[model samples]
Target: MNARIPTDLSSSLKAEEDSNHSDNPSFDTVLAARLSRRGLLRGGAGTVGTVVLGGMGLTACGGGDDPAPTTPPAPGTPTETLLGFGAVAKSLADMVVVPAGYTASVLYALGDPLNAGTAAYKNDGTDTGFENRAGDHHDGMEWFGLDAAGKASATATARGLLAMNHEATTDELRSSFFLHANGGTTTLPRPAAEVDKETAIHGVSIVEVQQAAGKWTTVQNSAFNHRLTCLSDNIQLNGPARGNALMVTKYSTTGVQTRGTLNNCGTGKTPWGSFVTGEENWAGYFTRASTDDTARGGATAKSVVSLKRYGRNAGSRSRHGWETGGADDKYARWNVGQSGASLDGSDDYRNELNTFGYIVEMDAYDKTQMPRKRTALGRFAHESAAFGKPVVGQPLAVYMGDDSRGEYIYKFVSTKTWVAADANPANRITTGDSYLDAGKLYVAKFASDGSGSWVELAMSNPLISGYATYAFADQADVLVNARLAADAVGATKMDRPEWCSTNVNNGEIYFTLTNNSNRAIDSASMPPDSANPRVYEDTKGASTSKGNVNGHILRVKEGAAGNAALVFTWDVYVFGAESGAAAGSVNLSSLTSDQDFSSPDGLAFSPSTGILWIQTDDGAYTDVTNCMMLAALPGTVGDGAKKTLSYTKADTTTLSVDTYVGQAPTADKLKRFLVGPKSCEITGMCETPDGKAMFINIQHPGETTAMADIADPTKYASQWPSNAGYGAGKRPRSATIVITKTDGGRIGS
Candidate 1:
């Protein structure tokens, strides 16, 4: 038996962006003057007009006097680029220009069909079986292999299981507009067929893939390949939220189970052979009943408070509008309203929104067991939870980041430690249940001195209970609305926390801060500390549009105490910016042509190879280059030179400069390995256990391009996998690409 699929259904939606955050922080022309020094480098083919700001000046970019390695290997070969940058070149709109001797290719993409019976995908937005095939918006992924002869273990480049999260589907392609679908009300409610198909397309899909010779192929016959969708009929809930009064609805009077999982995003591959897929952005799926809110069950004001914190309650509009379609509860449940005379919770089953945003677990090698939602993890827009292989009796720990504008990062330490994988089959799932069912959920509070603390959100903790902003109910409620709880505890609001990955070797953690425009120099926003130091205007495109710069990666380590209770030290390992931007003595690493990026999104630490794969989906710099992925060898959290950043506030209080002591993502260190199609985001990558093959997901190839414009293939924005000749024409699909060396050599050196 392989992984189980989660059936717990409820209501959840995307975390709402805090409107109270700093909207636009004003920056001076001086910062812009510094960026002007960045040299504009030309991009490769098809990027005639693309030019990037390279070779940042002021000694900070290339700040070190280190020379290029005397014995450099051939170009396009795996010569692991360390986290601290060296002499790598950064260019605009170009082919992946790596350090030397590294090779890269598309392993999979959007429209490729997995099974033998499925027809080939047409790159056009129009394609049949796409629902049963691969969905769009691929995010986190993992690689698991079958034990075989000559299997290279970590080095095995042959075959394995590929599991992925679909994240969010864009309306730019599928013609489903949230506010207005067709032209009028007649076209309203969207076709039930479309809603069903789209809902069916939203969950997680696990498939077995094989690498023969140098090419990787899908093993369609493998029973392990299964799909989990929101439309699935038999899924149930099994956490603190399950059977809770909040989860009660018309569908399940017992409140023990629900329907399906949605917004399945960042994922974690387990030491016990299962995968944890988090449901994010689930709040957008429901419509709150406005009228009888106070009357139904005569619920208290606090009951409604929970709904609002999680993006539910009365006056909420259904983006999908599936509720307007029919009188049957199947379609009407999406409406989320309480009405009628029936004494049961079924009358106007609106509380369905309470059932989403959970971390679901599934075994990769087995398919007979349904996926299970491990509720103890505490829900939000969970990005990913990374854990190392468990040793017998060790605390089964996993790290996570909530993907929202002002969310916090977390770590789950199991009450029951680890046991051998198959030593006790009878208590296997039970062991997992006990460990994850209840535990401490801590929010990160980064301080200026480079040390941070995991503030406990347990209601009994003074930080949570004593806060005046909101009340922390219990562990279940704390997990249900973790964001609000984290905010009340004064958790450090980061630059949009995205993904968290712990190194396979040293257990160090790295997380991506995907840009935050809400940051400012004001007291409430960014108060200019050494951690979140600079507050500058990052203008978008050719104009001075005010917003946050791309974003940076944060690395942290535990203090004296190795447990979650101890304070941790941290540093900004790398900041996303164009080399042409201004800089002083502070910005530690000297960014060059080979290693400059904006908005680092997907973060991965390949345990087999000890390589950090940093992928980018940048709006701040996409005008110059396509979204890209790079490889880096990261040092421990505090392993870099320390520099201070100074900021002067209007209130006459001078903010001392940020003190950064970290390795730079230099040219020779962080080099681009691959770039995505023109209008798409390059996300989700995993290779064979042996390192011979790589699987990269290209999501929404023509995401930003208009549908009307994409109708003509010749004028299409992205020629992706088709351009690489995986199939026929240049229709772009968000499928996973299988990348391997032509000579079948080991990946990144």
Candidate 2:
């Protein structure tokens, strides 16, 4: 979710476009019948007891699961409480706020010098060399523990490498105003210097941080401090589509390599000790000429179909206008039109757009190693990749979500079974090659009866083999244009699926369905469904927003076979809403002011405590307070009964939908923990092995400031770390904060 662009211009941005025009059935009608037959919707509301299955699976690589409890409690021992902190109140202040006994301290921020050789950041628009400094808009992050000797250590608590994604920069009118003097140029032919700075800040950053004397500080000039900018080269393309013709580019004639990873939104830690991130909203960074379709053989051509299907229709403009930076190769690569003399696409960047939208893997500890794009995962607007519980002899599974209005959820199962010893192998990237390089990709098809199945997205599948819209060439084509394949297989369309996390205790998976603006009850294009059953109006000041104004969290329990199970059951873990909304409808979660939240985005389960940390990147609820994070001790699926909801259309017609509701959470089970500064989104969370310290990212404070007001400190929407007495200037910046208990106990305890 790039908040840099205002909502009024969303329709013009290809990345934010709703491209799904499939005729798949909504879940409303079938779900009502299923709930009625089961007698679960009898009393309007009910609570059902669910049986817990034993033999919880192992954590996937980078699924962020803490170590399991050492051993079961002795006979007669008392059970431990799930949560032990008071809820923090909602806030609209311009600073970070936490619960009473916790201390939130700033550890790293945008423009901060990563190495001693780089001069200090003045916080003004005159800073340069962003490739050697902290990138902007920090999002998903993962902690790679290190030993006292500066070696990789899974249990290290005092020192580690913080690898995170700098998704995008704050921009206005196609210019990154916050990064230039006089707000730079907004017209075409963008300056090369401004474009260079903007490009360097939209990738990934890995920096070392250490704790000494009860304080956390970034280790400047450390060997692990490195930046992979948009200009970085030598990124390997591994998987089924590595050397395919669709990937050929002037820089990589063999189609085995590509340039830097762009718009990385989420982070993962591989089971083999590597950092994995997803390229999200990368389609908007490339410009396609108006004559591209004609030059590539018209609208009926396979290349033209792919370009349009991925939101890169002919005549689309780049987000930052980077293509007009001159004729140099660095700037020319941004233009993804057909301008080459060869038909193979080896002489130009016409195929460069095919190289991104992947789950990129890199070793956080090895600065010399290049990141590898795992193409077998199936490319799209990937939000994040969360692995399932690893079973030693069973195939490993990685769950993913395509973050768009009507996209689908996906999973990739490795061909090779997992081996426990490989978790700590000598070479992490090589180990990734064994599992990530070859896999069977599947898209979820959720049914109306609260059941779902994983449909394979391979050439062998009849739906893809006989797809009428787009003829498939080979396996590589299916992987490169996976959205088309998913549609051909009749996969369920989700309401902007964002992040996926695996519960460590039972191996159940949870996905965050961030709100969808295009959803409607009466419209045929996108009607309300059982899985995504909501359409309401929320007013913020003088404006009103329709559709699913607030999102919800959906959790799934695998079948008897666990992660490898093709069949599964699902339920709405909670529907985000205002505390005062009508119950059994919008406020289905029954959340009080202390536990209410909207547009749940970032989700992670504490590996040590089993508490689920939920973060928000919201716009609907900003009128009440800034975005916040909450901690919850969630129950398993099927813990609650089913209920039917009816919506009144503008024409007075009744539209009903039956849905499975999870057990209602009390303040004790769920509570707000932190709220970020004004106009900021609280995202990306991780903790130390012991769970004593938690790291959270606050992104894009003061993002709404007008470009003309760049020099006026008072006109800024916010002055965050600076107002909090950090750094040198009044400019707002995205930064990472470390939270710890005052009494030296584990967080959330």
Candidate 3:
């Protein structure tokens, strides 16, 4: 299944190029620019009664009795000692579990200074003493290696580079919305000083780390350490959308570059040691003023037509509008709709909104080249773009997901096969374009028999022309408005699909359906079937929350159709649950303390060892256990049994979760490996090429804060590594935790 990076697939490229050039979009009256924006992102549960991760077993909830509690069983069962880390109880909290013989430590934490001079970050959001530094909510990550003697300074870690993503934030004390001494509102637009900090906090940070006794350590201030932030003095843009009219603004006449990237999420590391980060949900940044979103009259004014497509028709507030302070175009260009008449696109921000949501590539070793946004990925909330095994002269293919309710999953297959030397800078993006910028985009439609098809999202397709719901203007419009196009094509609606990981041993794609609650029983929305199980209420903790919280994972086999092919096979792999929950049949595999979980998110399969690793991000069941990591030995498609899901919906209608059910792992199959700190997420899995050191991001361990309690230490939900109270001497910030064996053996050995 390895794809050559040089393969060409030009016939399939879809573009959403930037239509403006320059920082200011205020003068072109004929093309007046208004920032079009609006979004009420529901943070919890699925729209359906329940959404399973990559593998949810039951198609529908059947009447079954809850298992009664019994006397505690023995410590060990029939589990494999080699795969099981062993069951070990934690010292803190009511009950956070981990595998046996494994230990967790804080490599670094929020507000802890990486270098000597810079002051630590204060959770109060008042750490004015800032240069470039690590931000909150570290989510995705990757690693790079250097020789044993490659240290740049005496204080540097042995040798290696670490790149991590800070996904999003839920800052309370720093913001006026969560509480209030700051007038309960942003008193004014962000000042340059504050704007500067905000910008600095948004991009990726590259740091050097070395290993000792199998454990990795950081190299503070190594020349290789660098931060790429939102307020990056400036960056050059490249690609079909680079110098187009849609990209020009008062800031840059050439229209080939922009200042920063946002919503950096899931990652992909190349065979040549490069890193690809996706910018998801970028459309929400621009502020649109006009109510009308008409595209006719070629009218520059926002019309109802254009507004609905981009989720911004009018009367919507923009996100973190730091641009509101000054009339200067530098601050004004953030808005994207139409308003003023500045010519040459200087006053039109509408087109610029099209510039983001791309797959940006960066050479971990060097940052000289301006990262290019792979527009061919079809702009949406890109979850993560992962490449299949790369081989010389083989077609290059990448799998990606649009992280939103009712969106589609896509893959890019190159027309030109990959070449070994194509790994260099001379071929970096240009080479990526030969493959990335021009490949077919397909939407997955799950079938009733556990089979699926990759419906091509092409404008000429009958689904596009024959659709009764919407019209496709062109390929550009098709990809830009991909969701509607997907629905029109009858793409199967999933339950808030999130991160996707590939099983390297078998090239199977595993994704998480992180719970859903919006699904109205029998409503116009897609109904739950055997593939998307559950339609009942969950009563784990507080009951105010409704819908399914426990999730499941979906596993698919490539079936040699290549990434762009139309046919594939799939099934449910694992269902997250609480230990003593329900029917053995409903519980699927009858999960135990080692495998019990809710809302599985991050997943990865080791290339060197072929082991599938899973991580969780739970809001529904944290009251029982903190976030955790697990290990599994998974089989490819066509290897599981088939069964239909059937259930009773909240409205009394019966529904099913999926087309085919999955085989449950034995009691010893999946086991808990590690647990993370309080209020933090354990994400971004990666290991040394040799399978030694492992790295994971501990994001925002203590993220909760209130306006009035900003100054109180005890009110802090979590005082992670420092344990010194909220932002005490040190600010509570997200940090990467490194784990390995003290005996110099393979992890989980």
Best-fitting candidate, scored by lDDT: 2
Task: Write the residue-wise lDDT of candidate 2 on 375-449 in tens digits.
Answer: 999989988788898889999999999988888999999999999998999999889999999979999988777
Q: Provide the overall lDDT of each model, using Cα atoms, as 2-decimal numbers.
A: 0.60, 0.83, 0.56
- RMSD in angstroms between candidate 3 and the native structure over all alpha carbons: 11.6
Which sections of candidate 2 miss by over 4 Å?
Answer: 3-8, 29-81, 648-653
The sequence of per-residue lDDT tens digits that candidate 1 reaches over residues 35-123 is 22124333332211222211110011221223444665587764543332322233332232332323344454554566777787654
Report lDDT (Cα) of residue 272, candidate 2. 84
Global lDDT of model 2: 0.83
lDDT of 2 at 608: 79
TM-score of 3: 0.80
How well does model 1 score by local distance difference test? 0.60
Superior by lDDT: candidate 1 or candidate 3: 1
Would you estimate the TM-scores of all the predictions? 0.83, 0.93, 0.80
